[model samples]
Target: MSPKPSRGTTRTTQYQGNPRRILVGITGGSGVIYGVRLLEVLQQKEKDGIETHLIISPAAAITIKAETDYSSRYVEKLATKVYRFGNIAAPLASGSFRFDSMIIVPTSMHTLGAIASGVSDNLIVRAAEVALKEKHRLILVPRETPLTLIHLQNMVRAAEAGAIILPAMPAFYEKPKSIDDIVDHLVGKILDLLEIENALFKRWEGLSYS
Candidate 1:
């Protein structure tokens, strides 16, 4: 059987490279802001020699316009390289192209289902499959609530295939002060999963019952 998800800190281990390569896939989902904020954080990491590769699905482009003020063009500029979702020929589609990790922020149920079923009709799914087959990190942040049995089964299938199924659920214990604070909390967790360091949100120390 595929190994159970590692409860250890293996995900935090940084690979040695001048510029650690990270691939991001954005699908059409309600929380487009999660992907956008993640891009913003990684762009800053660019100054520290981190290379960010991006692929935004066609539906994501529409979601970006519908949900946020920022244009997809602006988001594209945040990445070191941006690939078309339909470009199955992109380097990321090959397992030979090395990247530290791949994350699909605000991943749609459709994309999750596709990945679960080993469907690689698009570059995003192909790259995610590459990550899984190559034994590299693949994180999927699904945003849907009131999940149906089908959705849960798909999630389980993806997890069994060695993908990190991170739902876009925020913790209120951090005492978020604004919308950005909540977004940062989720982005920070994604960074944490990929072993990237960040101070995007307040960490909980402990609770005092006194």
Candidate 2:
């Protein structure tokens, strides 16, 4: 967990000595914007030694086109490296590949179930499994609503295996004025899980009942 910053405190974007390698997996889910926004933020942190390795699922490619105006190629360019979804032979699929964390933004229920069941038929799931086996941070940002019992069970199973199931639910405490504000808040929460300091959204302060 990231230390809560005091109100009005400014965080420096100083470059840390060692490179922080993060593996990102985007799946086919409704809220594809979350994944895109995360990539944009990470791209901005490139100077801070944050290296992003991205893997976009096939279904996600379709979702990207359907949901956002940005091209899939543009999204791929944001990452330090990109991997194919079906390439299980990729370095990320191996437990030996050293990475700080793996985040699956907009994780589909299908992908969640696959990870929970220890099924690594694809590179994304394989990388997640490796993250678990290697004791690396694995954050799953599920975007589905009205989840079924199976979905909840899968989430529990994944959580038991050391994966953080962070849903794409934004808070209203900050009094968001636009959809971008809401998205930023959720992205900030995800950054907190990685212990990455950010001011993407205003932090909650004590209630002020004047």
Q: List candidate 1 stretches off by more than 4 Å.
A: 1-16
Off by over 4 Å in 2: 1-18
* lDDT tens digits, residue span 75-189, model 1: 9998999999999999989988977889999899999999999999999999998988888888999989899999998998888888888899989998889999999999999
What's the lDDT for all of these models? Answer: 0.89, 0.87
lDDT of 1 at 143: 86
Residue pairs whose backbone atoms clash in candidate 2 = none
lDDT of 2 by residue, 89-192 (tens): 99999987878888999999999999999999999999999888877888999878899999998988888787888898888888999989988998899899
- Quick one: how many clashes does candidate 1 have? 0
Q: What range of 10 consecutive residues in model 2 has the weakest lDDT sum?
A: 5-14
Best by TM-score: 1
